[model samples]
Target: MSFKITIQPSGHTFPAAADDSILEGALAHGLLLPYSCRNGACGVCKGRILAGNVDYGEYQDTTLTHAEKAAGMALFCCAKPLSDLVIESHEVSRAQEIPVKMLPCRVEKMQKVADDVMVLWLKLPANERLQFLAGQYIDILQKDDKPRSFSLANAPHDDGLLELHVRHIPGGTFTEQVFTRMRERDILRIKGPLGTFFLREDNDRPIIFVASGTGFAPVKAIIEHALKIGFQREMHFYWGVRKVSDLYMLDKIGEWEKLGIRFTPVVSDEAWHGRTGFVHDAVLQDFSDLSAYAVYACGAPVMVQAAHRDFSAQRGLQDDAFFSDMFTFAPKQ
Candidate 1:
């Protein structure tokens, strides 16, 4: 049996099956509610349960505190509606317009960009075209039906191809396959255009793009899309890495710098000759006032969390002005 779920403010309604999470149902029907880390680790999917009962499955309490539950808040990522429901959330404008599809993609190329990072380019079916914003991601369907998500490194304008930066995780089920068993022309099933971390072209605020390691993938997409659209707002990109070699696409960024985009490379590990500090610190040092700036941060959970806390609390950036995607790894057995 399925239940009717209605969203406030926008009044968007969709069907939610008993076996599916709210987010799963909403996305299955092409309804876009703001979300990230659909596993309920990130609070991006938190929303108020205006009416109806929901059974929230296994989720981090930190993402949904008891107090939040008492206040009628639930993580839509894991919430299963038990009855007709009404929710309060800000609908993602672009996400609502884009059609999400499941398509067969063939591995076209896999080039190692760094010691551990490989740039995987997949070719979409010739007859099926994918239209996704710069910072969105796709989920690779696995044997047991488990899906692993990776952000697209290239903008939609790139055409008929999807680029993803895959970092080799020692025993990662998917990454290991991509590096060893996976080959060119191998077909894989993918579903996508997920996540709400796209470019906010409507806002004229200056942008602060922060990335660490392969996290630069999506940030690169956002910047490239911005440039392609002729965005005049000032853009500053800060990339943090342990050593010079870690900045794999340094030359590409250098080319972008010549086009008038401000680029800063930061190294956190000591024994570095260049800027030695956190990437966000570099931003703070340069701009004491960020009241009018919007920050887009992606990378390790630690870096993304730190930037959100520091930027909002100390640097005068408004809460909504700071957007982030915290890349996480599944627990080891």
Candidate 2:
């Protein structure tokens, strides 16, 4: 048995199987719902249950509180529909456009970009080329079947090889293997071309790119692709880190500066001599009027959330003009 699902605001309709979560059903049918942490950790997939009954499985209270549930909000990622339903959501438009795939990739090269960051270049099977937007990510399937997602650091034109910037997290299941046991020519399974964080090249608006830590990975791909395609829009990059050593690819930024791309390196710890403050603050200090610009942010959830709030409220940026990808650390079991 299956239930029909309708999403309002966009009026997109799809089908949900009896045993599947609404999100899983939608995704299976190539619909792209706004979601992160499909395990129900993040609240990004929360939506109103307008017209049907649902049974929610295990989920974090921080994502959907009892009060919110009583008020009709449901986390579609974990909510299994008990009957045909209507839902109100804003992010259902792009759900059908992005394609996801799983393929085998061989490690081509690995370079240490920072003290704790390594850039891995993986060559995809020549017969199975991946077609993904510049700012999207791929997930490495691990032993326990857990997946670790990483943004593609190289632009599409690079072809054949996918680049990823991975930060070594102490005791992290995936990072441990990446730093210790992973090797060249080793085969790894990856599923991708996920997320909707790509650049919308349709608009000629100026761009503000903000990144923290390895968050710079996708932003780097977007910028390189933009340059490759001869996009004339003005772009300003603000990258934040704790210390000078953390700014691993500073030299690359310098090279980009020579090409007329505005680069600002911000540091929070006082042990440095350059810009000392939050990265978003540096952007605000330089460009007070953001109403005419589009902002792309990637990094810690705290930084992305903070930038989304402040840029929209204080900097005159339209709410829709801000796009972000929040990288969260897996909770220790």
Candidate 3:
């Protein structure tokens, strides 16, 4: 059985299946409810049950008090609709709306997807969760040196483990540790859900995402989130690498391709059968007008700069329709 849920103020409504938590249903329908630690250990998802009933699944007592429960407040992350429901929650529509957190996370898993690229999965405390926009990034805090920033590769719905793609920069101490000394269960500090590079869902315009090298991280997050919300707009992804070996995650990209998204891998240094030259050039060669589309580009500063300049000045793309995150290497220590 499923129940109809209505949100106050916004007046948005969606169906919550019997097995679905209120948060799950809301997110599945593209409703951005403010929540963290989907396990109910945090009170961030607490809201008033304006009408109807919910199962109010398992939760920490301190997070949701008995009096609050008696007063019709429940954690949306843990609550299951028992009947048609009316709830009160202000949706999160901006990056500033989500809180920034500084917490300890363990390096739960790591994989070398390429000769120079290592994928790290950081696990937070069982009692905590980090809420973030899909394309935002986090700072990996360090003890002696400055923090290292990496775009989050996982979408918000898959937040059990924070994902980061690290490129081993020669002479950079922290990345060297990731390639050499960083081990499973090693603790690391992080502060974020930062940056304003998330997708804008208000308009129904098509999208073009440009990524270079490891810049594919945040683009992967945005695309996955877009797919999860059932976003129907046409999407084309262009990934640029120096060589065939530099391109990773083709399996995931293949899945996206099957879902009607267009994927183009551009090789710069050595070429076999794909488009060559700069990544942005491939985009330029395809589209002549971008006035009605939104472009999200992430990569090195030079590529981002060139794309922004060319896309707007030549292709008639509006300044506001362009969004980007430039990946700059940390200073060598």
Compute each candidate's TM-score over C-alphas. 0.70, 0.70, 0.96
Tell me the tens digit of each residue's lDDT in model 1 across 22-88. 9777755545576655677767779999999999988888889999999999999789999999999
**Tens digits of lDDT, candidate 2, 215-319:** 999999888877765678889999999878888777777878888799888999855767888998888788778999999999998889989888888889998
Which structure is stronger by lDDT: 2 or 3?
3
The ten-residue window of minimal lDDT in model 3 covers 324-333
Residue-level error in angstroms, candidate 2, position 232: 1.3
The root-mean-square deviation over C-alpha atoms between each candidate and the true structure, in angstroms, is 13.8, 14.0, 1.9
The per-candidate count of clashes, in order, stands at 0, 3, 0
Question: In terms of TM-score, how similar is model 1 to the real structure?
Answer: 0.70
Over the full model, what C-alpha lDDT does candidate 2 score relative to the true structure? 0.83
What is the Cα-based lDDT of residue 245 in candidate 2?
84
